[model samples]
Target: MKVILTETIESLGIIGSEVKVADGYARNYLLPQKKAVLASQANRNMLKQEKARFELQIAKEKAFAQEMAARLEGTSCTIAAKVSDETRLYGSVTERDILNALAEKGIEIEKHMLLLSEPIKNTGTYNIPVRVYADVEPEIIVEVVAE
Candidate 1:
């Protein structure tokens, strides 16, 4: 029996895939679990329509990420923190501090997207890479200055 998978099955195929399985397995497992629908002509047509819509939505998201990446290029933010005489920060600068600084400039970013190897501990200029999209990465300079 041929069916359209609603979700990925490791041994079978990915979501929206059409595969042939034993009739008993389809009736007893996939159908009962709502993991697939019979691949009738009508269901295949519906899947085609849904796939078109999903492709369009994915294109839009990729374009938006590209635009954000362009805007983020060469942008820099400054963070001030208390430091000892040796220029070591009293506390390290974190993602939240970077987010807040960017927020002040009207640039909103998620904390998880900021890839920091470690917190900033010294007074210096640092370049931070932000993953704006799976394919897009933009660097922004962060100046850590003493308060």
Candidate 2:
């Protein structure tokens, strides 16, 4: 099905771009979520008229993401946990732990934005990427120490 995207979808296309997608996906997810609309002549013309506003909004969002990336650069957080052994922790350091540590440091971010593939199970320093926006990921130092 052909539809006009109203938001930037990483797997799909950017805002205002008309692209073809699966019928069920378009009907169930995209349309219901208001992320896209049917690509008709009237809708296309309406999107064209709103293109300038969308561009401006996209620019502002990118700028904000860049600003957040700058702030996150060289940022580091230390989490102290109970160690069962010299190098291993009793429990792994999860996203929530990292979030709390960041919060204590006055840096706030969503859990989904923290690109941790797995929990930290060892006591050491690790680099964790924080996805502030599209293609704007900044690595922060996470040092897990034995308490």
Candidate 3:
């Protein structure tokens, strides 16, 4: 049976994907659980149009992110943290900290956009990569200092 997935199905496909499933699975498991709808011509066309509009919006957002990234390149943001001693910080600097610091610098960025391997453990100068889009990349400086 042909079905359209309302959400991602493990090992199968993502939302808005059309997949073929067994009749028993579609009627008994999927539909009863409201996980998918039976594939029909009307729904297919509707999905297509919606997909097109969503893609267009994503492109526009990507462009805006790229412009913001360009403005953020080579910029430095300082974060003041409480220090226990001369060398170590009381706490680490997480991506949320970076986002808040950027906000203070008038460069607001979402936490998820910061492609960080991990939080900054020690206070020093660090290069953080902010992903503007799949194509555009921006690197910014983060200087962690003791308060």
Using TM-score as the measure, which candidate wins? 2
lDDT of 1 by residue, 2-87 (tens): 99987656568656789999999999999999999999999999889888664665577679989999999889999999998768
Considering only N, C-alpha and C atoms within 3 Å, which residue pairs clash in candidate 2? none
Model 2 worst lDDT window (10 residues):
8-17
Q: Against the hidden reference, what TM-scores do the models get?
A: 0.67, 0.86, 0.61
> What TM value does model 2 have?
0.86
lDDT of 2 by residue, 42-91 (tens): 99999989999889878988899999999998899999999998999998
- Badly placed stretches (over 4 Å) of model 1 are 1-49
Stretches off by above 4 angstroms in model 2 are 9-13, 19-25
Q: Considering TM-score, where higher is better, how would the candidates rank from best to worst? A: 2, 1, 3
Candidate 3 lDDT, 4-121, residue by residue in tens: 8865564456566899999999999998998888899998887787786646665676678678888989989999998888758888899998988888888877777788898787
The superposed Cα distance between candidate 2 and the true structure at residue 39, in angstroms, equals 2.3
2 versus 3: better TM-score goes to: 2
Q: Model 3, poorest ten-residue lDDT window?
A: 6-15
Question: Highest lDDT among the candidates is held by which one?
Answer: 2
The best-first sequence of candidates by lDDT reads 2, 1, 3
Q: How many residue pairs clash in each candidate?
A: 0, 0, 0
